[model samples]
Target: MKGFIIYFLLSSITGNPLMAFLGVIIIYSLIDRFYLGFLPDFTRIFRRNRQMKNSLKELQVNPQNASATFSIGILYFEKKKYEEALKYLEHPKLKDNETANFYYYMGMTLMKLKRSDEGKDYIMKALEVNPRIGYGLPYIALIDHEMEKYAPDRHIINDLEEKIEKFANTENLYKLGRLYKKLGNKEKAKNLFSKAMVEYSYCPKGIRRIHRKWAILSRVYKIV
Candidate 1:
């Protein structure tokens, strides 16, 4: 529809009826097949590169805008271009919460790239810059859990629990409950899950996952 409108406008400006109709059909067909349809891999790559180039141009115009850099970094990260994200996010102009978030996401990207030690270091730096951020803690715990699955360290779990108790936000509650479940503390997990269900009833992801976990646990305990 949008493509048709654009083609119509262009053809009207050029004052050519046959050209107008053909232009609309051609433009619409290309868009319907490539942009709206299952485009080829090369087309997807080309689009992504074009988007990155545009984002880079925007960043150049506003070099000190941490949000712009972060936005571009996020785009790169989504494309699995970790090196590019790292380069943009680690620019010295980034500071404050944006910088901290950049480090946290960089850690996640590094972890995805399978550089766990480097990821941990960046995540630790994120936490150090702002302990109250509440984002890096879960990543740290996740790394720890990955390293020693059976005997996961309790310190991260304990600290997270305390933070959840104090904050009681949806994210904190969900994380704490999952961490409890991972640590083989079923009773604690159940309680935390119940709390999460109440606190995050309106949140689709939290509600669904928490309720599913609660139902499973209830069945296991013969409570329902």
Candidate 2:
């Protein structure tokens, strides 16, 4: 009702209903982009670009700045520039970092580079550092699939199942279920799909934002 009232007032002021509707849409999109986080954040990309530029400047002054190098690598990784990401992520200064996230991103970038074996190794290191890392299991499963291995790491799969049960991570369940399907385990896949649906149904409102995309995808999975 409030939206309609605003639309009506805007239409009266503009003397054109179509223009008013477009204006309302623009305002709503801005609100979602800034406050609701439902829209893509263009500002974040710009901010990252600015940070990357600053990191480059920092590197010119002190080539031994590991943090700046890692930051640049992360920025490039987010931009999907895997080769550039590797250059900094593999720097000697970072050899002893032992950060789980560092290894995880290195593994993911290597996987993108089609170096599945190296990717798998780094992913394993990440799991050793933090078994419960979000998305770690899924990437392991993905690498297993890429290598044409029927047996995904059972430890990772088991951990993901535990996470789903404890945290109601519908996304992980859905993805793991897809992995099972790809591995030709129809029965396990179907069971996980069912659980994913049920879990999404019972997902709490507070965490719905995290699960909503997977929940919607699971609905489509149910039909197919």
Candidate 3:
């Protein structure tokens, strides 16, 4: 009713339907920008960029600071600066850390850099360190699929399927759907996408915040 009233008033004042429609669109976009967050978080991006700059300064102060090096590399990775991320992540000091997270991030950075085989090796090492790395299975499946090594390591697929059954979250469903789609299991993929859509629709708004990216991807898959 409010939208109709606004449109009617705009149309009356402008004496042009298209202009009134455009005005309504602009108003809705503003509302979405401020309240709905359908757009990227510019504030978060700006803060991250600031952190990257600070990390660079910290690195200059202590060039051999493993923590600082890893921090800068992680920030670069999050910003999709894969090559720059590798420059820091590949620092010899990071190898001394030897944690699952270190290996996972290195693998992800390598994958983004198109070093798929090396990425796969690192991801496998990460899994070997801790099979329950929450984000590991999807990447493993993705890398294997990219390498066309279907079922090369059945354990990863089995592990992912098990996790999906255990968690049954929207994001997990969407990830599995993507894996199935990549492997040419269209019917299974379609079913998983449909399931993810239903889960997204019923999920609480606050919880949906975390699943937002997956929800968007699911919608795109449906369209395709």
Candidate 4:
């Protein structure tokens, strides 16, 4: 997927159809061999970790680029390297809205690692720096959702639904559908899920997952 995204980006910049096609084939082959064949999930995670390590090395050589530092931090967080993410993201020299996003993701990583107090501090700092950062709200909602012990809240779910609707991306739509289902709004869930199915059908896994979800909803709600 990453290779395909990179290829597509290059193709967009260079206007080369053959290169884009080659990129698709390369990504497909890699996905088939690794994800569909025999590579363990941990192996994929390790590869990503190594990639982040290399990126961090590059960032160290050019510490003035905030984008590189933030990207490296994001990659670290994605690999669950919370301490490393914090080390880079908490650099006092880094100060900007992008750095605020780093703090938000760091807080989310710490929260996932079960350090709520430290996580809250970082999240508060994120909001202090950029109150309108979209990512921070979702993290807060997640924390609230977790603390509520999985008991669904219509109000919170509704707010998320509104945000997802306003944003209207494939991921946000899928999440909105799930949240609506959790909140017992089956009709709304089905509609959002159908929209997501249409929007994300290019990706096989996403299509399959959405179809399975719709099948279950169909049984439960008689949704056509």
Question: Residue by residue across 46-161, what tens digits does model 1's lDDT show?
Answer: 88788777877887897777777777877788788888777876777664554567767777777667777777777777777766554435453554445354675667656645
Worst 10 residues of 4 by lDDT: 213-222
Per-candidate local distance difference test: 0.63, 0.76, 0.76, 0.63
TM-score of each candidate structure, all chains considered together? 0.47, 0.72, 0.75, 0.46
Tens-digit lDDT string for candidate 3 (83-116): 9889888989887877888888888888777777
For residues 1-224, write the lDDT of model 4, one tens digit per residue. 77667777879976997878787776766775544443335667788778777777877797776767777777877767888877777776566544567667877767767777777677767767876556324544453444445465667555644544554545555565666577677887778767765655555673454334433443344253
lDDT of 3: 0.76
Candidate 1 similarity to native, TM-score: 0.47
Per-residue lDDT for 184 in model 4? 71
In terms of lDDT, model 4 sits at 0.63
Model 2 bad stretches (over 4 Å): 1-13, 16-21, 24-38, 135-143, 150-168, 180-190
Q: CA lDDT of 28 in candidate 1?
A: 62
Residue 168 of model 2, lDDT score: 43
In order, what is each prediction's RMSD in angstroms? 11.9, 4.4, 4.3, 11.4
